[model samples]
Target: MQNSSAFKKRIKRRISGRPHVFFAVCPPGLSGICAKEVARVSQKAEEIFSDKYNISNINVLPGGIEFTTRLKTACLANILMGSATRILMRLATFKADGFRRLEEQIKAIDWELYLPSQTLPDIRVTTHKSRLYHSTAIADRIKPILHDRLFLKEPPRHYDVTGSAAPPPQTLMVRGENDRFELSLDMSGTPLYKRGIKKKIVKAPLRETLAFAILTRLDLSENDIIADPMCGSGTFSLEGAMMQCALPPGTFRSFAFEAWPGFEEKSITHARNRLMAAARTDMGVQPLPHILARDLDQTAIDHLKQTCTRHRVFQRICPVCDDFFNMTPPPIKNNQGVVVLNPPYGIRLDENNDITSLYKEIGHKLAADFKGWRTGIVCPGKKEFHALNLGLSTMPFFHGGLDLYTAIGVIGR
Candidate 1:
């Protein structure tokens, strides 16, 4: 009984040192992109918690950013971030060049902080331009460290070779460059981009990150009215609604952090309560500022409706099946809002149509019919961009591995 008590105290200390970290992993060649994303998100959070908390230590990493906080900021990043893939806690970072060095560094830490008894941990490793290029070998090397240290003759009975179980001890993430390794733990089981609720996908569907990019370009506000003219799958509209309502992106899904040792239900509850309390309802006379999504394809419209319903934003949005050129904007409740479109870019052989003509029609309708409204158009190529003839300045953005341009036009009254 004395031995048991001492072991429990040791476990408590280990868990206390393991802080919750939110890592924003960015695509390659876009290194440091996640840092900017983290800063933007952190700024928004500081505004929200201005009275209660003071945000400290915003730092950038190779493919992400790290900040120290006692609150459940991962929940905030999960919901609000558009550019991040996963939000993880940084267990530790140290230099290790080879298998032996990796083992020593990993074994030196107190694994009990992350791993609880009766659970086996899943581990994943990634290497780039390093001596430890074989990730499988690295995983093999670390297995014994865990087995020997934990007093198991074989591996833990709960250990799973398949990735189905929550990784006990912790999920090791080894990133290598130039024969040097940096190891961190993954607190997010799947990429934060999954957002849990979007189970179905459409052809050439925009990722949630790209959708958030479009929203950022628009400079969204809680009270502003927004529309997606070619809102396929309703990604843009749904992300927009969550932003306006101050909903954390992670609210819709489960996180890997929940499985970590010392995870408290009260911490999750406190974070969620703060989010709910911050949620503001629209009480204005007009219907919660129109979030209209229109598409020419009936199939696309059906998919959009299903997605909106699944996300519980169906009632908040107006979906219409009609050609964009023929459709009219819903009567402006206050004549203050913006129209954003993500039209098909002639990328794939099938989508590659005479897009120049399509842009010409879009320009004509915007200039002739929708005066006093601001417009944003996202397209794949420069040739299609010139065809719009909207006389608006253009900004370059990326979506789905393609370089795209957005032309923003302010229609004169």
Candidate 2:
């Protein structure tokens, strides 16, 4: 990539300088898995963009990875970061011990770099252990400077902020900790989790980013068959097909960077062509048979069918309406493959609920029918997990505002 004269010229003409960006990985449940996904993709990024944008540094944050790369590499990071929630572009970082210092730092950073005069800026701020420790105070301090410097319009709030007029396409976040100030622009507008195709969601649907992480644990091959027996709205199966086809997860969505300077349609088209081309080339194996996905509810199957078709992944997934506990894994060329399940996790589920019996039956089916098959379950707690009684190596992670446990092991091993 570094040797490509075309890429070089694109860099010079489009992204003439370096821009720092970071990945916001999700999983209110487990930061470790997020780390693993970030690490895995970062290596791939190095292999692709190493010539133009070597990763200068990597630091672990509460729910993500803070890493630095050049301006030209942001699109690749967004396209490739499977577990990220948002890729924030670092705009400025300086000392801010007080309000005056904060104003100075904001003033020194060029707001026009990302926010065009016609665009609106949404600001979020957090402060800790410094003279300016109040988050609202910090936001209040920075608002006027943004308007005065960039000629930007502020979204007026009345009874509610959402009631405010919808702005064009930009947001700013200011963070301060221990007298250090840093500003980052949201490069991924809708948070990487929302691809807009997961509309048939059931209660407590698995976040796509977290689902991708679970699918990654399998170390899959083209020869391996992938199935999600409890596939509500088919997140796991759809994600698996996308991974197999080497499609970018954000293929259908627009990004915040597209509205910024030097990121015209031509540049975006160039980057997308290169990224998709490389992905296609690297995917050496043939796409597998339809990803096996089943759910008890016929409505869910119907919805999964519609959603998958909308996302253009319908052809790759075979949706069935059968109860997971009552059914066996579908026959594939490989008798031994993998089954991933997302069961009910009601925070209010108690001893009176049917989950215990459901999990027990699920375990019974796995032992009786799915011998030698790899199994993974996203369950709520020890009660449901122990019900499986499969002695699965566990990975604890959170999803959809709920804490959950993941268990994976070979069935009847």
TM-scores, all candidates, are 0.80, 0.83
Candidate 1 structure quality by residue, lDDT tens digits, 1-413 = 21266755765555543334546665433334456666656665666545333335767776566766433445455555666776666666667777778888888877655554434456677888877788888888877776555453333323222233454234667677777766666666677666655546557766666566556666677666777888777777777787777666666666556654445546455556666667754544654576888887787787667766655443587778877787777555444667777777644325556678888888788777676677778767787788878777776756677788877667554
Please give the TM-score that candidate 1 achieves against the real structure: 0.80
Candidate 2: misplaced stretches above 4 Å?
Answer: 1-15, 19-23, 28-51, 152-169, 277-287, 332-336, 347-351
lDDT of 2 by residue, 1-413 (tens): 22257644654553546556665656565455556655555565566544545565677777677776665566556666677788787777788777887888788866655554545578888777877888888888788887876654533211111122433257898888889888888877778877656657766677888777777776555556787888877888877777776777876566666656544445446656656665532322654656789887788898888887664544778888987766656665444587888876575345677997888888888888887777778888888899998878887787666667888778776
Root-mean-square deviation per candidate? 5.0, 6.5
Worst 10 residues of 1 by lDDT: 154-163
Candidate 1 segments exceeding 4 Å error: 1-22, 27-54, 116-122, 144-171, 281-286, 311-313, 331-335, 346-352, 409-413
lDDT of 1 at 220: 72
For model 2, what is the error of residue 52's alpha carbon versus the real structure, in angstroms, after optimal superposition? 2.9
Relative to the true structure, how large is the alpha-carbon lDDT of every model? 0.64, 0.69
Candidate 1, residue 165: Cα displacement in angstroms equals 13
